[model samples]
Structure formats: structure tokens, C-alpha cells
Target: MRHQPFETWLLFDDPLTPDQARALDEHLRACETCRALGHSWRSVASLFQASPDLEPAPGFANRWKARLVQEDQGVLTARYRWQSWITLILIANGVSLLGMLLGMTFFDTFDSLTEILLVLVYRLTSLLTVINIFQNLLAILIRTIPGLLSPSGWAILALIVSSGSLLWVLSMARLARMPGRA
Candidate 1:
């Protein structure tokens, strides 16, 4: 149609206010092209209405659940498929870094690396001393734990742990029992 807005209204499903609807109707009556387009759209709408509504086959829910589980498992498996190779590459990289560090520390064949090597060894020894102190404290804690407690103390500790675990399970059960929640 020569009238552009009426042609748009005829070809597409556009919302029409009362005034716009009246103008479109007036245009359609005078324009043969717009009238033909409207008739075609109505025919298409009728065809769609005449078609039967289709439903999925039986066991749809069970089948859907099975498919979902299968896809999840497949994704999980694929995600870890390169685990060994990735781990191997990571280990190789770490070892290479460590070797490079050590080489720069002690493998200085020439005296040019001597100064840097001494500085690094001094820093490393200080770090090791701190680590050793922490390790000794942890060892002392482990050794004294049993001796610092009597049979009654052990029983009390066990009672506390059991009560806490029971409370946690009860809370989880209550949450699962709530409406609109799993």
C-alpha cells in the first residue's frame, strides 16, 4: 500500500488504539494491496488454529531426568579427562621453577653468581629456621594433647562433639522440611 503505516499494521501484529484502528480500516477499504495482505495473514492464523495441539510421549519426566543425569555425568567426566596430563604439566613446570631457583643458588660454576648465591642461601636458611620453629611448636602441641586430658575430660569432649553434630543434623532436617525448599 502507498500508505506506509497502514501497510505496517497489515503485515505485522501491531497494537492499534481506537483512532489508529479506525484509520487502518479506512485505508484498507480503499487499498487493494493492503486488503490482500490482511486476508493472507488471517488465513495463516486460521491454519495455525486448525492444527492439533501436540503432547510429549509418556514417561517424559523420567526420560528427562535420565537424560539430565547422563548429560551431567558426561560433562563431569569430560571436565577431568585431561586431569593427568594437566597435573603432569603443572608438576613439570613447578620442578623446572625449583630447579632454576636451585641452579641459580648453588650451581654457579663461575664466580660471577657467587654473590647472589650467598644472599639467596642466607635468606633460605633464615626461612628454614622460622619453619623449623613453627614445626617444633606444632609437634609439642600434638605430644601434650593426650597428657593434658584425663578420661573424664575425654568423655566431656566426646559429649560436646556429639551434641554439636546432633544439632547440625536437626537444623539441616528442619531446612529440608520447609515449604518451597528441598
Candidate 2:
């Protein structure tokens, strides 16, 4: 049986059936591209096996466990900060909407339709404000988190934030550049 080029290379990593293995072997023998690919895969696998495995210093695991705890605490603290901000924003918006409704009803102002429209506008504005505030607070917290100053901590934080930002930007750019929703 014949196999496609990718399948031939893929079989190198698995327990191939006798016929599959024979097919791949024949293909590699005749095709320089497949042969080179097989050789490269073997070279990578051999290097991984031959590399030295270094044991960590005494108490290394304990130290790592302690660091992990610290990182976890930092993450919890960050989450709490954001949660508090969101709660506050939500409460404030809810109160504002309640007050607006009370004021409108007590004063007996505007027709029913006008009152409904005004309330809708007020709700939308409040929602936008809450989102804006939350984003700003989150940015500030990410920038100020103290653990981020450590080399490893900074790398971890940067990797997380940068990848998130890159993905957001890429998605937005893709949307903007698309021909149409279709």
C-alpha cells in the first residue's frame, strides 16, 4: 500500500504495521525528501536521549514549592483586586440606575416612551463606564503587581500578558482586514 509523504514521516514516531512500515521504508529509500525528513527526526530523537540530565541542588524541590505558593498567593491577590473593583462598579451602576428611576417616577416627567428611551441611554452609559473602569483598573494592577519584579516572575507575567495582548490585537486586526462577515 502507498502512503502520502506526511503519513510516511508520521509513522516514524509510532508502532507501524508491517505493511505500513515496509511501505515507508520503500518510500524513504526512493525519495530523498522523505529520507532527509526521516534522518532529521532520528537526529532530534537521538539528541534528546543523549542530553545530560542534571539533578537539582539539595532542597531544590522545597524551594520551588515555596515559590509556587508565593506565585499562587500573588495570583489570588490579583484576582481579589479585580473582583473588588468589578463589584464596586456594579454596585455603583445599580444604585445610579435605581436613583434615576426613582427620580423620574417621583417627578412624573416625560411621556412613557421618552422615559423608557432615557432609561435605556442611562443604562448603556453606565455599562460602558463600568467596562472602561474595569479595564483601567486591571491594567494598573498588572503593572503594579510586585512579584512581577523578580526575573522569573517578570518572564511569566510578560509571557502571559504579551501573548494575551498579541492575540487580542491579531484578532482585532484580522476582523478589521476581513472582506466582509458574509
Candidate 3:
């Protein structure tokens, strides 16, 4: 009635001793359940052996990989778009809040709209005055700098700069070429 060794022997690929094989054959003859199991197992194994190995068509792997990448890119693009929308909305809200706060403060401090306009004009005038001062200074420097240096002086300055650059380059090259430095 016990089917332990006989079932294991029939199902497994382990080789059986002559005595074990004889005992298994005797058990198979008497045990209908084990005999049917063994028969089905052999039939399934034969089916597997007779069938050809299935392979994908050419470029199938490449197509599948490309599809995966495309899906990932779609997901990333949507995420980026969502983030961009959120950022734009937040920035708009912040600008609106700042404008409202500044307007309220300015209205509370100033008596009239004309005062606000005058203050804006004064600030713009100050900024423009500073810019104009810098522009005039730049113009003066541009006019006087060339007069300060003769042609030979300019050539000497260029030579000095080029020699310094060449020295730096040669030092770097030597450092790079030194062994055990990497």
C-alpha cells in the first residue's frame, strides 16, 4: 500500500539499482494509481522532447526593450509636465500674493496715488543716474586707457600675458606627465 520509494523512483531522473527497478516494476503492476502517474509523466516528458524550442522572431528583444524605454519616457514626460505646471502655479500665486501685500503696504503708507507715482519716478531716476555715472566713467576709461599705453607698451603687455600662459601650460603638462600622479 505504501508508495514512497516507488513514486520517488518513477518521478525522479536518478538511476535505479537492478533490485530497486525490480521492486518498482512489481509495485507498478499492483498499484493502479502509481502506474497511471508514471504513464502520464512519461507521456508529458515525450511531448516535451518531441517539441521544438520556441524562439522569438528576429529583433523581438530589441522591439520589447524599445517599447519599455518609450513607456518609461512617457511616464517621465508626464511627471515633468505635472511638476512644471505645479511650479508655474506656485510662482504665479507667489507673485500675486507679493503684489497684493506690496499694494496694501504702499496704500497704507502713502496718502494718494500721486505719491506712489512720484516715489516710483524718484527710484527710477536714482537708478538711471547711477547707470549714467557708470557709463560716463566707462567712457572716460576707454578714452584714457589707450592714451596711457603706447603701441610698444601694449605689445610688451601682450608678450608678458602670453609667456605667463605658456609657463602655466607647460607646468600643467609636466605635472600630468609625471608618473604615479593619477
- For every model shown, what is its TM-score relative to the native structure? 0.42, 0.33, 0.49
Better by lDDT, candidate 3 or 2: 3
Q: What TM-score does prediction 2 earn? A: 0.33
Kindly list the per-residue Cα lDDT of model 1 for residues 35-153, writing each as its tens digit. Answer: 88889899999999999999999999999999999998898788777787799999999999999998876656546567767878999999999999999999999999989889899
Best by TM-score: 3
Model 1 clashing-pair count: 0
Q: What is the Å distance of residue 33 in model 3 from its true position? A: 1.6
The 10 consecutive residues of candidate 1 with the worst lDDT sum are 105-114
* Candidate 3 lDDT, 22-137, residue by residue in tens: 99999999999999999999999999999998998899989999999999989989999999999999999999999999989888999987998999999999999999999999
Q: Candidate 1 vs candidate 3: which has greater TM-score? A: 3
- Residue pairs with backbone overlap in model 3: none
Q: lDDT per model, in order?
A: 0.89, 0.83, 0.96
Off by over 4 Å in 3: 17-19, 58-69, 72-76, 107-182
Instruction: In model 1, state the lDDT of residue 124.
Output: 100
Each candidate structure's count of clashing pairs: 0, 0, 0
